[model samples]
Structure formats: structure tokens, C-alpha cells
Target: MFTGLSAFPLIPTDENGIDEQAFVGLVARLAAAGVASIGALGSTGGYAYLSREQRALTAREAVAAAGTTPVIVGIGALRTRQVLDHAADAHEAGAAAVLLAPMSYQPLTDDEVFGLYRTVTAETTIPLVVYDNPGTTHVTFSDELHGRIAALPNIGSIKIPGVAAAAAPARIAALRAVIPAHVTIGVSGDWLAAGGLLGGADAWYSVLGGLFPEAALAITRATQASDSTAAREASNRLEPLWALFQRYGSLRVMSAAAETLGLVHSPNLPLPLLGLDPAGRSELEATLLRLGLGA
Candidate 1:
């Protein structure tokens, strides 16, 4: 009955890349802190920049760190085989589920999008989480497409980004209204936990869970208990941290936030990302301090 949940931010590495042991340790900490799941190599985790090998290695380490908890592997790519390969890797790595978004290279027609999800679903036996984040991937799967995908047996769930949180309840209810009860609808916004829960999402894929699982878990539990007051209180307390996602775009800020929280070695990002500048760093630090999460 995980009607609400949180996931660790998959922070990327500098030049040499993420330390396997350190990454595993981060997941272990998240698991200990009560996170229901872990997401590695995501936008927050810099999935796009990771080499295929790095992605697989990160998945393996994440699954190992999760131990008993579920690991949701991000499998968005330009090619279907690549996504299938990631899903296969997740299965091999002992992941509980796989999350995927549409390919970013080309715009897909509704029929094409449905076909892609159907094809991917056919390849994997594990539970799948369809990702809908128009911000990063540039396109979103329509509700019709989502319903079509949700109808499949192995299509376990869908994780809509936070921007959709306000509209999620009715939208999800509409989707669920057509599909069976087995498929779940989840949200990926760190600040939208309460709204997502209230809106009827089954779980939350949190970016903050990696650095502050305690706060994320507390808020989720409060929402699940139907304590709107407490949920709002926790969400308010977390506003400063969630604002960090807005300060610098998602990926770079996530790394910077990880650095501010001392979850990672440095704020160094991959080429083209080049980490954050001084102003960005100061904003990140201010957000951290305001949230009482000292840098």
C-alpha cells in the first residue's frame, strides 16, 4: 500500500565518474531512511550523459545498495533496443522495476508512441514505469497513449513529473477509470508529494530522497495518513530545498544540491554541463541553508 513514495536522486560523477562504493552507500542510506525505491541515471542523476556501461554499472550498484527495496532504472534513449537493454540490465541487476520515457531525438506520433511502449512491454517481464517529463525529454505521452500502455499486464505503473501534479488527480482518475486497478499512477515531483497523493498517485519518485530521505519520507507518511496539515507543514519546510530544483535546471542543480548536502564528492558535471557557476552555487547554498541543510 505504498500510495506515496520517494526515490534517491541519481547524482552523476565528475571526470572519472561516480564511485561505485559511494553510490551503493548512498542507496543503502536511502533504504535505511525509509525510501520505498531508488532511481539511478535519471535526469537528476544525469542519465543522458552517462555512457551505456556507466549506466549499467550504476544500475547494478543501485540494486545492490537497495538490497531489499525496489530499484527503478531510468531507461529513456533514442533507440528501442537501448531501452530494452537497460530494462534487461535492470532485471539482471535485481531491480524491482524499470522507468522509461519517450526517445528525445524524434517526435513520435500517438500511434508511434503507443507502439514503442507496446514493443518495450513485450520485451520485458518485469514491472515497468512509463516516464512523462516534457521538460527534459521534450515530449510527453498523451493520456490516450498512457491508457493504452497501462492496459498491458506488465506495464506496472506510470510516473508523471510534478508539473502534472495539480492536474494528476482528475487525469489519473480518468486514465484509471478506463484501465484496471492493477496498474499504478505515480508522480516524480519532490514538492508535489502531498498534492500527488491527494490527487491519487500511488507513489512519488523523489529527487530529494537521495540527499534528505528523512524529510521526504516524513512528508509522504503524513500525506498517506490523510493529515493534510502535517503534510503541508512538511512540504513548507521543504520548499527551500525543492526551490533548488528551480534555481538551476534539474540535472546540474541536483548535482549541486548533492554537493551542498554532502551526498557526493563534488558538484562537477559532465562536459556540456560543466557544473554550476558561482552565482548558481551561492543560490544552491542559500537554498540549503534556508532549508537548514548546511553546505
Candidate 2:
């Protein structure tokens, strides 16, 4: 489907803050690069740092820039009401779907998590997608939960980060066994594109797609088309590029890579997260050069 070749975390950042114009350019670039969908205000987009208005504005900008492509707004928040509110805003702002995580207040009971998705699905007309990123949320929704949620008419997909890259294939296979055909399984790990495709993921969401949409899309399409050799070569070519961010962390180093490639003006990060250091910057640039990504 068109959804398989999209970029998440098409974030807006500059030396100052969210760069509206730059973000518009980013959307256009992703569309031209052949991305069929895009997501904003996701974890990597620093959604927590944006004010409510900024969040809505970002959604609007993304939708406006995306043209005919689908834009999914990240509606995840620490509160249920907030997620519902964001879902409303995103829907009004032209989002085709909303991606949300379970509330972060406490370790949720299975019933509570199930109820949460039920409530969200009930409250929104737009399609809702479950986000499963155990590294950040420390919660892994069971396949049982996915089965239940995926059965909901409004639930469209599950975004699962392949953080445990090695074990991802098994987990993905298990997830695929339960989820419905229309309810997609989205992988969110930078290095697990081919593996995820082979394991039955319908689509992928990761910063790897943001920095290298052309290459990531190529790899995903190849794998989906059963071209194992081409997919392997594509992944191999992107290994050093992924390593550049893997070595220093995706969020921080990706901003630097964006700046180095002239994709964005500066690596402006949120509070408590410092921008790249000189040595780190030098190393990232060198790695990007080696990957032939530093424009």
C-alpha cells in the first residue's frame, strides 16, 4: 500500500524553534521523494515541548504541504482528555489519522489500556492507530490487546518500534498473526526495514526514513516486491548512515545531519537535550560524507 513508503518525524526545528517554512519545504520534499504519507508531532518531533497551538499549527502546516498525501498527527499525551482533544484538533486540521500511545501516568493494567483505546476510538471519527514503543513507554501491549484493538472499526494500524532489532522478526511475526489485514503493522526502528518487511510489517516509521527517504523507500519497496538481494544491498548502503545516528542517538544527531545536509538551518533541540558538540558534529559530518548524504 501507499502507506509503506512514508516518513515519520518530519519535524520542524531551526536555530529558533519550529520553522514553518522549512517544514513546508520538508513536506514537499518528502512527497517528491515518493513518500505516500507523513507524520508529525511524534516522539522524535518533540511533541511534549510544543504548546497546544504550536501542535495544531504544525499539523495544519503539514497537511497544507502534503498536498494529496496522507498526514497522520501524533496525538499521544500523558492524559486521555488531551489525546482526545489533540485528535479533534488534528482531524479538523486535515489529518487523515491519529497515532496515540497509552497514558504515561503509570504502568497500565491490560483492562485500562484496552479501555483507553476503546475510549479514543469512540471519541474520534478519524482513524486511530496504536503506538507501541516499549523503550519510551515501558509498556508492551500484548498480541491479545492488538487483536482486540485492531478489531475496532476506527483502529487502523499499530506502530511498533523494532528496538530489539534482533528479536523483531519473531515479535513482528506474532503480531502479524493476530492483526487484521486492513489494520497495518508499522515498524519504527531505523535498521529493521527489510527484516520488518519480511516479517510481515505493512509499513515502517523511523528517523531513518526522514534522513534518507529515497533510500529507505527503495529498500522497503524492494523487500516488499520479494527482491531480497536488492533490499539487502539497499540496507547495506544505508548501514553507515544509520550507524551515524545509532552511534550518537537518532534525535540529536539527526538534527545535526539535517543541518549538515542543508535540510534544516540549525540543530535546535528542546530543553535538557543539548545540541551536538564540536567533536560529535565533526564525527557526524564525516560519517555523513562517507555515506554520501552530506549535501
Candidate 3:
């Protein structure tokens, strides 16, 4: 809640449906490992792939498992009414917040994005966080647009991908100046988080933290304590994992890692986005060992 690590874990699923026990167990593990919050239905969580029933059940189990640790449900969709429906289910499931990313097959204008948030926030009393993942959604959020959304009644946080390594600190600083102090700035893309944290960003919207919450917490705590050397060291130790993320995608790598580590079984990922190939398997498993995840 106070500018810490928020995990977006791989949404564990089986052939039948959302693996309730496996999903809840992962949430409990992250909470035990000191994650400030857990998010379900994120890009990594495969939100768009799930049916409305699957999404509702996933949110319910996640919130129940998280207990005191807050759960943020991704309500991102191609349409306003559909996103509103997810928000209603998430709030009813006891989620602490909803993450909104305006994704569509057709390109969207700035005004349309703002209107989507405005309508969803007005409909749900639960706090909403702006999820700006341009890489996947192709819906970029300009600084002016971020400021406008920050003024929305229930909007509370913005999850942004970090800028280039050299310019990250400056970008975070500039964003801080534009958005109100109460609105939190969270950095996603695991590779970009260290610079953002060093630059005073409030939270890390982490993917690997989905598996290694304590390790992510270590990096954040060191930065907050003003120990840049230790923070960088901690972040550097996980560089091997980031390499895999860049090459074959975080969702693929995370699913493979989770299965190899026995955290969960091989998942039934939506088609055209299956597990890693043979070469990726060898590389990813080796990195997991290097990171001492006992793969």
C-alpha cells in the first residue's frame, strides 16, 4: 500500500478451468513472501483470454487467499460495458482495486480512453489504477492524458513501463511533477524497475516478483533505504532471468518456471501462446537454477 512490490503472477490454470487451489496457493505464497499486493487478470494473468465466469472466480479466490494483502483485478477489455462488468464482479469478489487498460482491435483516441476510465470509475466504488502497457495494448498514455485521468474520482495509481535505462529517473521525476502527490506511480516491465525505484517511483509492478516476491522486495527496500549499490546488486543478480523475458516473453518464461519449480502444473495457456520451445526450456531452466529457485 505504501509504495512497495505488487506482483502480477501467471494465472495458473488446468484443462478444466482456473485451477482454484493452485491459484490461491500462489497468492498465499506471494503474501508470505512480503508482496504488498497481488493482481489477477493482468497481461501476465491472461485476463483477456478468460471468460467472464473464469474471471469472476479467479478474483474471488485471489481476494480470499490474499486476506490482508490487497488484490487488484485487471478489468481491461475492448469495450466499456464489458470492463464495467468485470469491475462489478471484482468489487463483489472483495478486490481492493481494479486495473484498467483500454485495449481494442481498433486504434483508440485519447478522448475515448479517458471516457472509458471515466465511465468505469463512476460505475464502481472500488479504486481504479491506470494500467498503461503500450507494448501489449498499443494504447499509449501521454503525460497530459495521465494527468487528466489522475483527476478521476476513484483513480489511485498508474502502472507504467519504465523508460530507457539512462532516462528513467528523469521520466519518473517528470511524471511525479505532473500527477498529484496522492496518485502512485508504479513501474512495470521487470527489467525497467530498478531505475524507476531509484528515481522515487512508488511501486514495482513486477512479473518475476510473481515467482520471487522476497527477491523483488529486497531490491525495493534497498532503494528506499538509499542503498543504491545493494539495490543494483540485488537487481543485477536476476539479470539472467530478464534475458529470457526479453527473448521469449515473460508469460511463456514464467509459466515454464512455475511448472519446473513445481509451484503448479503445466498450464493450459490460450492458443497461439503456448509454452516455450525446446531451446527455451533448456535456457529458462538453467536461469532458474542460476537464480537459485531450485528448478
Candidate 4:
């Protein structure tokens, strides 16, 4: 469940709320593409914006649509109680695993973050993925903190943020030395996925994979086959898309891409968030066409 490409699809929505049909189509598309897992309600899925009921619905639909593919649902919330509730909901939905990011309005301390994991893991039977995305959650995890949280039962995987290509090997090695051997290390940051995989990370918790699994899987398979050159080449081929993600943030870029592909209606993001502007959309369309990703 923790290895290979875990595609995190966007939970398409509009003023009427979650577009269940589009969301299910995204999940089914990923399942058919043979991604290692379908990561619904992750950062890409806009889990933080949805109500508990909405999130639970998304989880149930993702698992159902994914069929044989493993489904990892994000269960992050501001409060531990809410997180526990979300975890229970995910378990009830028959999710293969749950991903948790330490989300907070007030900055959290290392101990506070550790306590969050300890409480959830102690109460839930489902496996947890520690999402270390400082970019979004604003909670950073030191190697020491990661080791402590990973020591808790049900700590299945750690989804680490991107490291530079030069540092990936040492970073992964350092992480491996501290955590239990059973606990896998998955890499986020789509641009750095190939480097992370080649550097010995166990999985790619990918944004691009959610929309375009075939492109992401090419890199994953090349890495699995010990073809480092192929993996790097595959990643490099998507550099233009990666550049767009870096410029506009993945959520917005992916929303625009989904709309362009007609997978979902325009203005798919949640309230207070808007899709790309005209110029950005034009650029994205050109890039997509150049990459042979046009609808």
C-alpha cells in the first residue's frame, strides 16, 4: 500500500458541493491505470476545505470506485478529536489507510504534533501516514520527532517533503536509520519523485499522478527496474508541468488542468480559492499540448 505511485486525485466540487460523478471518474481512472494506490482527500483533494460528512462521502466513493486498488484517504483536521472522528469515518469507509497532516491555525510544537499522532494511533486500528508537508501544514518534522511518532503502533508510512536531488540519498538514509524497518518512506513533491525513488524512497505520493497516472507510473516503473536514467528522463520530460506547479501551487494548477481536460466543470475548487487566471490557463493549455496532455 505504501510503495510505488499513490495518485492523489482532486475531489472535484462546485457551488453545489462535491461533484460525485467527477470524483468517482477520477478515482476509477486511476484504478484502471494501475496506480499503486489512490490517495483521495490528500492535499490535492482539498480535504482541509470539506466538512466531515463531505470528507467521509469522498472516502466511501473513492474506495468504491478504486475497486481492487488500495485507497489511502486523508483524515487531517485542526483538532485531535476531529481527526479521530475522521479516522473512524475512513475506517468505516473501508479505506486501506489514512494520511494525516498536522493542520493548525496556531503553530504547533514538536511535542504537540507527536501527541496528535500518539492519540490517533492509540485510538484507531487503521494505519497512519505522517504527512510532513511544511509547505501546507506549516508543521515541520525533525528526524527525531519522526522517529518518535513512527515508534507508535499503526505508523505505516511517513510521507516526507521534497529534498534536493543531491540530498535525497542522504536524507532517505538518515530517515531509514531512525524509523522502524516496517515503516515505509513515501516522497511528496511530484518534481522530486524520481530522485526520491532512485534514492531509495518507497513511494511517490504524487499530485501529477492523480491526474496523469501513466506519466507518473513510467518514472515509478523505471525506478523499480533499476533504470535510473529512464526514471530521470521521464521526470525531466514533465519539467514544464512541474514549473507550473511550482509557480502557481499544485492545487490551483491541477484544478485548471482537470477543467481543461473536461474531467470536471470549471471553477472546481472550494470557496475562497479560485482556479488559474486567463494567462495562467493559457500557459497551462500550451504546456499540456506540448506535453501531449491536451484533451
Task: Flag regions of model 4 displaced more than 4 Å.
Answer: none
Q: List model 4 lDDT by residue over 170-223, tens digit each.
A: 999999999999999999899999999999999999999999999999999999
lDDT of 3 at 170: 86
Global Cα RMSD, each model: 2.0, 2.0, 1.2, 0.7
Two-way lDDT contest, 1 vs 4, winner: 4
lDDT string for model 2 (190-232, tens) is: 7766777766677877677766788788888887798878887
Over 4 Å off, model 2: 14-16, 163-169
Model 1, TM vs. native: 0.92
lDDT of 3 by residue, 16-95 (tens): 67777777888899988878899889988899988999999999989988889999999988888899899999999999
TM-score of 4: 0.99
- Predict model 4's lDDT versus the native: 0.94
Per-candidate TM vs. native? Answer: 0.92, 0.93, 0.97, 0.99
| Model 2 whole-model lDDT (C-alpha atoms) | 0.78
Alpha-carbon deviation at 2 in model 3, angstroms: 5.7
Best by lDDT: 4
The residue pairs in collision within model 1 are 10-45
From the highest TM-score down, the ranking of the candidates is: 4, 3, 2, 1
lDDT per prediction?
Answer: 0.75, 0.78, 0.86, 0.94
Model 1 off-target regions past 4 Å? 163-168
**Deviation in Å, model 1, residue 136 alpha carbon:** 1.4
